[model samples]
Target: MRIKVWITSTVIATIGVAAWAHTGATGVVLERMQGMSAMGESIKTLTPMMRGQVPYDADLVRREADAMVGHSGEQMARLFPEGSGGGVSKALPSVWEDSEQFAALAEDLKTAAEGLKLSAGNGLATAQSNDSGSMMGGTTGGMMGGGASSMMGGGMMESNQVMTGEMFANMPADAAFTMVAQTCSACHQKFRKEDE
Candidate 1:
């Protein structure tokens, strides 16, 4: 049930991005938004499998994890430079105000993605233990991909425009995935602006 809610929320958020484009947003601002959007799509692909709504495929899981790993860590941190906040940006002042913690969170995400890849390759999937529900029918549509329309400066994107922890010791994949997501949540809660 919890995974269901998370998946629903992520999907809803990503769907909104589809119609919203980077109008004035260009350069690295747009680049990071697109990176976040891509990461979100990768997480979306894994959720169904994590939910057991779809069959477990190690190859697919590893691929998505790799995609996430690509956008995170130093890669993610480089997108934000000094004086890149405000305007259409959704980033809060703390990103620049508290750069160290933000960078830690980014590194944490990369580490988590790497852990997920390792777990998947080692045959640790939710499908292995029947923790997932029955295979869900049909497919979700219209996730064309966009982000917080018309941003003028460089900044961070929504976490859901991208994509939790040790309570998930049951499966290795689950554990790694939760850790990866927790990093995202932590970064968003502290760095990203609320949708006011």
Candidate 2:
């Protein structure tokens, strides 16, 4: 009777631990999914911005910026927890050890997004009025402040202007694509799986 009771107790404890681990893993997966979705939305928002098809809508820009900033703050960390199925994640173990730096990058992204929202909120007049283009210019001094300056010439255009299509009409189509690529590279370098 004693032997059977001890075995049963051990089995129950093991199951409980497994269940707890599974729950944590599930949370991590969900967080990753949410981050991916937010990133996708941010890209979508950039489409019109890149084209300069519409005048800068401060409210719309702010909302998109808010989403991106929120994702950086809330979801980036959760996606890289230890033991989560890596799937497409490029996150490295160094993220845990160098959490402060990782978080700082995330914070920088958040700050950039916030600045974008504020700049966009003030309207196109403010953006164009300033010698430096507003957030839409893709300039280093702009909201993203030129991190991916090569992606777009550092010039602020009206929201309705469709800057890339209008200004670089003759260029190969790949210019706009680099914006997304740069973002992926930045994130993958720090958080994602390093190529073996």
Candidate 3:
């Protein structure tokens, strides 16, 4: 009787663990997915404008960049609590194990989004001056600002007026957007499962 009782208790405990893992983990997976989805939607909104397929609208870029910034940084890191990576989660083990790296990537995303917003609202020069090349892969001052100055014949790009659609279409601001996208891709490649 004692042996039978022990076996029954073991089975019950195993079932309990499974249920706990499944139910508890589902909420975290859903939350993180929702946050990521919002970021993706923002990227989709900006791409057409960057490509000149649609009219360039700085206000629209600022709005979407703000949304991207909102979804990133500490807000993003909070979505992945400890032990919340199993079950249906697309997040890999590295996200929790190498958490500092993950946090750095999140911060990088925020910086890129902020740069885009600054460029859209203030001017491309503001974004270039602020770039540290930490998130975007290269120095904006050297690559973007210098290049743009030469392209524009070395005069400061007018900061007060919204860029003409033609000027916006041809602007180096596209590089800023590209850097943000690349940062996202790098994080996904390192810490997210492809099947997910």
lDDT of each: 0.60, 0.44, 0.59
- If ranked by lDDT, best first, what sequence of candidates would result? 1, 3, 2
Worst 10-residue lDDT window, candidate 3: 1-10
Error of 3 at 177 (Å): 0.9
lDDT, model 2, position 177: 26
Query: Residues 1-196, candidate 3, lDDT per residue (tens digit)?
Result: 0000001222223223333333444476777776677777677677666665677688888898889899999999998888887666767899999999888778777866776776674334334345564332333334334333232232212123222334433334554565467567767767876541
- Regions of candidate 2 where Cα sits further than 4 Å from its true position: 1-25, 85-90, 122-185, 194-196
Deviation in Å, model 3, residue 48 alpha carbon: 1.4
Question: What is candidate 2's TM-score against the reference?
Answer: 0.51
TM-score: the better of candidates 2 and 3: 3
TM-score of predicted structure 1? 0.70
**Cα-based lDDT at residue 13, candidate 3:** 33
In lDDT terms, how accurate is model 2?
A: 0.44
**Model 2 per-residue lDDT tens digits across residues 1-196:** 0000001222223223332333334466656655655655565655455345556555676677677667764456555666764543434677777777666555545544544454453443223335353333522223322323332342121012223323222221123223333433455465654333
Superposed by TM-score, candidate 1 places the C-alpha of residue 79 at a distance from the truth, in angstroms, of 0.4
Note each model's CA RMSD in angstroms.
Answer: 11.3, 18.3, 18.2
What stretches of model 3 exceed 4 Å from their correct place?
A: 1-25, 121-172
